[model samples]
Target: MSWLALFFLGTFTGLLAGIFGLGGGFLLVPLLSALGIPVAEAAGTSLIAVWFSAIAGSSLNWLKDKFDGGKSFQIAFLGIPAAQLGVVVSNLFPDRLLKLIFAVLLLGMIYLMNLRQQLSEQETDIKLAPSPPTPGATGRKFYWWRYASIGAVSGFMSGLFGIGGGLIMVPLQLGFLAETLESAVANSLGAMVAIAASGLIGHAWRSEVLWIPGLCLGAGSIFGAPLGSYILPRLPNGLVTTAFRLLLLILSIYMVRASWASGWV
Candidate 1:
């Protein structure tokens, strides 16, 4: 039954990965821990699910003509090193401290989602929208500072929290990188492949992962990912953005509750 539950979780994560290009760790860690898995172990195992799901999701995006390959690869190049570094750094922190930090990140995400939602509503009335690409906002072009910053921060967070940084990446791409919801999600999925793999390597080195659970999760994700990517391009941007924000909000609340229960707050 526990394995079945984990499989369901992975299925959901795979869907999110396809739709949002996130590593799906935002919800996985807390849920796993709540199911009696240790924090580090949960993170480690989650990375495995993230890696497989990301592969499937990203592949789907490519087939669906939803991805920007060059830009995505550029971000991945910068994110890879940063992700590896984050994995090393995460082990140095106490589990309780890490939970607190993760909780804080969740709060920040919720705030960002709300802000973006408001701005989006406002923009709907503007009428003339060329996406008004900022002078150097996120896009096809390589904005060194922008990509570098996102890579470093999201990668580290991905490693630290075992989140594969998709949550952070999507919003950052939209807010600062000057991406639409669609492109942000596509690029984010591309980046998660590297970020989650780096984190998984670190965890595997420490023998923190449970192969049975990881395999079960990966198996479920295999079926869910393609389905999600298939649905992504068909959804309205506003609907997709709303769903993303709501998902983050729900996950943030869950993490906050878990942190409090664990006395990490």
Candidate 2:
């Protein structure tokens, strides 16, 4: 693709990542495939893009005090190694099967997102408070072990499917740490940087990244991320999750259809 095209893709993906706390790999992978990259190659290239975008977005969040660096770093240490392991496992699987699994997983996540949103909305008077850092309640007493386990799971999914794993991470944080949704989103974006970086390193060793396009996408994300992050705080949690879930559902269906049509199923 032309440098201009790559730049625009990067910018757009970065903006989305900043706004949604996504790695933006879900969008990047499909875009790369449409540009004629092989499935495995596209996944690898997408990881590079995701890494750049995550770094740019997370930096902005950090500067704005939207993320805690100490906490994020701890999670990354756990996630990064696991991400490499996931990349190795992905390399072993057939691309077609991998795509199919990704499609199904996306569908499942969309459904779960929707369910969570609905439940949140139905409980009209539910209190929205920042969870206290307590042993049994907050899981902070076992922070290292809990975050490490979460990071490992998230990293594996990210490497296997070329996704940011925020969809998984945010919910896990909410369930385990009892974090507010916005806090979870911010922290997830920070965690994604480590996961994407590890995956990119693994893919680079395999010569699977398309540097030009990946860089282009990264450049765009640099500007767009702050804008998205700015908007995230103003939105209601239920509304944000509902919109995100709907978008995921639509994207999931499109992926399923495209895979079937391509006989990759």
Candidate 3:
């Protein structure tokens, strides 16, 4: 029954991953911890599901020629090392503290999602009332340092929280790299392939992963990811963004309660 539960959870998370380029760790770690798994083990185990789902989703994007290979590669290369560092840092925190931290991250995500929705609305208005192209708009420079910073921070989050880092990467790409939502999602998934793999290695070294449960979750994600990819371009961005933000809010509340219950507050 536990295996079945994890599989279903993975399927749902995979769907979110496909659409948002998330690794699903944000949802997974908290839920797993709620289900009585240790926070560290939950975080580590979530990475296995993240890795497989990322591969599934990214492959679909690649096949459709929707991927941003160059940016993905840049993020992945730097993210690999940073992920290791995040794992080391994660081991220093206690479980209750980690739950609080994850809850805070979720609140942050809600704020970013609100910002992204506003940006999307602005873009729609611009399209409706076309303006003269701003000078140099098409010639915006690609800054390597910006990409490096995005990769490093996202990678660290992935390792520390068992998230796919898409939660960070997509917003950063939109704000800093001027990528469209779809493009940022694709690139985030591409980068996650490497980031999750690196995180899994570090977690395994510490014997933190729950292999059987993680595998069951990953197997389910394989099916869910393709479905999410198929739905992405067809859905309304505003609706999805609003719905995702709500889901994050609910999860954040749950995590906060869990942390408080841990007698640490």
Candidate 4:
């Protein structure tokens, strides 16, 4: 294996991980496979690297007062258990068809993201025109159950797809919880630590992980994550969120291609 290339991939993915709360699977899984690693091993190793990256990025967010620990913890509380069930579900479906479905869902997410932007725009215009609802007025009661459901759904997707679950979590946080983009990212990263840890345990138990490569990736990711976190605060929220949607769209397109390649689409 080319350790240098792996390290570089880790660095690149780690940067994205920190920026988007994405575990960077859209690159890491393919890169590792290109390097001759089996897909299962690649997923396992990438998950470990993702976990560490999330740890580093979230710690920085927490220190900067950007993380919502309470919400993050609540999300994780349900996510962990659902992940186990999701792993089970992964085995139930044909991989090619499942990936196609996931791709379609990602497209739906892109649409929802745009819809969210429209709603936020309306809110912004309203705020500009007149005395909006009092600042202290409860905007919406915090729906703990909805958050848990988000965790469960995202967790299931994570386990089934062998991913970090951040893609599912981040947009939902924005749409449902009305969190700022930065805060959603910070909270998503914090919550993913638990989800990734659960995935690692399952992968390790199955002996699917490539320990040396995973370690190398994790080492590089920690260094890269802080760089991304540093850049995150400086970027426009709308730009970053648009980039996030584009990234998901690109990944979904990749999945569609993969499905066709596998003769399933």
Q: Each model's RMSD to truth, in Å?
A: 4.0, 3.6, 3.0, 3.9
**lDDT per residue as tens, model 2, 1-265:** 6888777877777666666656678777766766667666777777776776677767767788898766677667778988888778878876656666776887788765654455444333345435434346455558767777888888887776677887777777766765667676677778888788888788778887777777777777676666777888888866777677776777767666667766753
Q: What is the lDDT of residue 199 in candidate 1?
A: 77
**lDDT per prediction?**
0.73, 0.72, 0.82, 0.71
Point to the candidate with the largest TM-score.
3
How far does residue 90 in candidate 1 sit from its true spot (Å)? 1.9
**Candidate 2 TM-score, true structure as reference:** 0.81
Model 1: pairs clashing at backbone N, Cα or C within 3 Å: 138-177
At residue 146, give the lDDT of candidate 2: 74
Error of 1 at 113 (Å): 1.8
Model 1 regions more than 4 Å off: 12-22, 118-127, 130-142, 225-265
Candidate 1 TM-score, true structure as reference: 0.78
lDDT tens readout by residue for model 1, 158-203: 7667776766776677667656666777787787787778778887
Q: In every candidate, how many clashes are there? A: 1, 3, 0, 0
Ranking by TM-score: 3, 2, 1, 4
Stretches of candidate 2 off by over 4 Å are: 115-141, 230-243, 262-265
